[model samples]
Target: MLRIFYHTKYEFVRWWRVAAGLTLAFLAAGLISFAVTGGVNYSIEFTGGTLMQLQFKTPPDVAEVRSALDAAGIQGAEIQQFGANTDYTVRARDEKQVEAQDAGAEGISKQIASALDAKFGAGAVTVVRTEAVGPKVGAELRTGAAMAMLIASFFTLIYLAIRFDWRFGLAAVLSTTHDILITLAFIKIFHIEVSLTVVAAILTLVGYSANDTIIIFDRVRENLKKPHKGETLSHILDRSINETLPRSIMTHATTFSATLALLLLAGEVIRPFAWVMAFGVVMATFSSIYVAGPLLLWIEGRWPRLDDAATARAVRAGEAAAAAPRGADRVSAR
Candidate 1:
C-alpha cells in the first residue's frame, strides 16, 4: 500500500489567520450578493408552482412557446430547454398561478399543456411529468426544511458535548456552522436553486465536517494522555493534524471523486445536490484543519484548563514510578 505524509510534522494551524480572512471576505460577498439578488432562488417545491416536463416530436421555438402560454393567460411562465432540443421544462410559479393551484392540483399544469397543444398541434406535444404545489404547502415545506436543519444542528451539538470536552464541542459545532455558511454562500453566488435535495446535501455536509473535526480532536485527546511535557496546545493540535494527514487525504480524495462524478454525470434534477456536495468536501477539509484547530486553541486560551498541567505531571510521575520498579526488578534478577 502507498504511504504519504508519513511521520510529517507540518504545522497546519499556522495559516489560520489567512483562512479566517478569506472566510470572512467570502461570506461578506455572499451577503452583498444576497442583498442585491433578493435572497435564495427557491425551487417550486418551496415556492409553490407548477412544473411541467414536455417532449415534442420536433424542436419548437422558445419564443413561440412563450407566446402560446401568454395567449392562454398562463403568464410569467419560465421556459428552458432541457436535455435535448425536443425536451423542455416549463415553470409557472407566478403568484396568480400559485393561487390557482389551490383550486386543483392540475389546474395550472392543464392550462400550460392545453396552451402548448393548441399552438403546436394536439399530437405533437407530450406531457412527460407535472408537479403542482400549493402556496400554503410550499410555505409549510420551507418551514419544515429550516426546522430540519436547526434540529440537526442542535442534536449534533449535544452529541459532541457528550463525546468531548465543552471547548472541543463548541469549536466543532462552530466549525460545522462555518461549513454551512460557506456552502450557502457558494449556492447563492452560483444561484443554485434551493430544493429538498440541496437541503439534504447541506445536512450531509454538516455531518461530514463534524466527523472530520472529531477525528482530529480524538487524536489530540489520545496525544494528551501521553507524556509531552512542554508542548503547547497549538503544537499538540498541529501534531495531531499531521499524524492524521494521510487518512484525511485518502478519505477526502475518494469522496470528492464520487461527488465530482455526480456533478458531471448526474442529471439536472440532482446537479444542485452534487454541486453542494463537491464544494462541501473541500470546505470540510479546510475547516477541520484551519477553523476547528484555531478555534480550539483560542477557546483553550480564553478558558484555560487549569487541571491539564497537573494531570500531565501526574501521568508523567506515575509512568516514572512504574518504570523504577521494573528496572529494579531487572537489576536484582541480573
Candidate 2:
C-alpha cells in the first residue's frame, strides 16, 4: 500500500491547532449546558415506570391514547410511536395510583388493548413489548449504571497505560470522559429522556472514542520505530495524526452525514441517540490530536533529557554521515 503517513505531518499540526480551538469552544458550551440544566433527565424506564408497546394492524391515532390515559387520571403520561407504522408506546410512573393495584402495570396494558380492540376489533393490536419498573428497581439500575461507568473509566486508564505510555493512556481516559460529560450536558440541555438506550449510547461512544485514540497511538508507535524515530514527540504525533487524519475525517464525515440525515428525518425518539453519537465523533477527533498530544508534551517535556533523546540521535547520525570524507571512507569508517 502507498504510505502517505510521512507526507502530511505538517498539515495535521496546523489542523490540530484549529480543532483544539473548536473543541475548547464546544467544551464551554457543554459546561454551560450542565450549569443550566441538571444532570441527565432519566426517562420513565430508568426513573421507575411502566412501558407498554402495542402494535396495531393499522396506524393508530396517538392523541386517542393520551386522551384515554388522561381520562383515567394518568398524569404526566408519555405516549410515542415506535418502529414501523403500527407500534404505539405508552409510559407512566406508578407514583399515585387511584386504583387498589398499580394501574400502570400489566392490568392497565390489558385494559388498553381491550379498549382499542373494542373499536378496532380484537385482532387489531398485539402487545409487543411491556415492562414494569418498580421504584426500587429503577433506583438499583441508576446505581449500577453509575458504578459501571466508574469501573470502565478506571479499567480504561489501566489499559491505556499498559498499551502505550502512561501519558497517552491518562490523556485518552480524560478525553473519553470529557466526551461523555459533554454528551450528557447536551442531553440535559435538551432534556433528552434518559432510558437504557441513552446508557447504551454513552457506552458506545466511549468505545468509539477509545478506538480513535488507539488508532492514533498505534500510528505514533509505528513512527517512533521508523528512521525519523528521533523526531520530536509533538512532530511525531502530528505526523501520525496527519497520516490517519484523512481516513478519520472520511469515516466520521460519512457517519456525520448519515446522522444528519437521521436528525432531519428520524422522529423524536431517535434524535437523542443520533445527536450523542454525532457529537462524540466530532469531539473524539479533536482530542486524539490536541488533548492527547499536549498531554505527552506536558508530562515528558518537563525534563531536558527525555525531551530530545529521539531527535538528538537522528541529528547526530545525519551530521556524522554528512561530514564523512567519501563513500569509501564512510564505509570504511563504519
Candidate 3:
C-alpha cells in the first residue's frame, strides 16, 4: 500500500487568520452581488409558474419564440434550449402570470402553446410536458426546504453534543453552518437557480462537512489520552489534522472526481446540483481543516476544561524543572 502524508507534522492552525480573512472576503463579495442582483434566481418550482417542454419538428429561432410569447401576453418568460436544439423549456413565473395561474392551473401553458402554434403552424410543435404549480404549493415547498435544513442542523448539533462535548459539538455545528453560508454565497454569486435538487445538495454538504470535523476531533480526543508533556491544544490539533491528511486527500479527490463528471456530463436539469456538490467537496475539506480546528482552539481558550488546565500546569512545571538543571550546569562551568 502507498503511504502519503504519513507521520507528518504540519502547523495547520498557524494559518487560521489567513483562512478567516479569505472567507470573510468571499462572503462580502457574495453579499455585494446579492444586493446588486436583488437575490438569487429561483426556479419555477419555488416561484409558482407554468413550465412547458416543447419539441419542434425543426429547430426554431429562440428570439422568434420569445416574440410570439410576448405577442400572446406572456411577458417575462424564460426560454432556454434544454437538451437538443429542437427542444426547449419555457418558464413563465412573472407575478402577473402566477396570478393568472390562480384563475386556472393550465391557463398560462395554454397561452404559451397557442402562441407557439400560431408562430410555427398548428402541427409543427409539440408540448412534450407541462408542469403547473400554484402559488400556495410553491410557497409550501420553499418553506419545507428551509425547515428541512434547520432540522438537519438541529439533529447534527444534538448528535455531536452527545458524541463528544459541547465544545466539540458547537465547533462542528458552526463549521457546518459556515459551509452552508459559503455554498449559498457561491450560488448567489454564480446565479445558480434555487430548486429542490439544489436544496438536497446543500443538505448533503452539511453532513459531509460535519463528518469531516468529527473525524479530526475524534483523533484529537484519542491523542489527548496519551501523554504529551509539553504539547498545547493547538499542537494537538495540528497533529490530528496531519494524521488525517492522507485519508482526507483520498476521500475528497474521489468525491470531487465524481462531482466533476456530473458537472460536465449531466444534462442542464442537473447542472445546478452538480455545481453545488462540486463546490461543496472543496468547501467541506477547507472548513474541516481551517474553520473547525481554529474554532475548537478559540472555544478551548475561552472556557478551558479543568483537566486541560491541570495538564497545562503540569507541563509548565516539567519545563521549569528541566530548565533549572541546565541553568545550574551553565553556572558551574562559568
**What is the lDDT of every predicted structure here?**
0.86, 0.66, 0.85
Residues 240-327, candidate 3: write the lDDT tens digits: 9999999988899999999999999987779999999999999999999999988877665544553445544544455322421111
Best lDDT among the predictions, by candidate number: 1
What is the per-residue lDDT of model 1 for residues 1-334, given as tens digits with 9 covering 90 to 100? 4375888989777788889999999999899999999889998999999999999999999999999999999888989888889999999988989998889989888888888888999989999899999999999999999999999999999999999989889999999999999999999999999999999999999899999999999998888778777676777888999999989999999999999999889877789999999999999999999999888776655445544565444434543124211111000000
Q: Worst ten-residue run, lDDT, model 1?
A: 325-334
TM-scores of all predicted structures: 0.89, 0.70, 0.88
Model 1 superposed RMSD (Cα): 8.3
Q: Is candidate 2 or candidate 3 better by TM-score?
A: 3
RMSD of each: 8.3, 8.7, 7.0
lDDT of 2: 0.66
lDDT of 2 at 46: 62
lDDT of 2 by residue, 91-159 (tens): 766575313124445665565556666656779878887777667667888888888778877787788
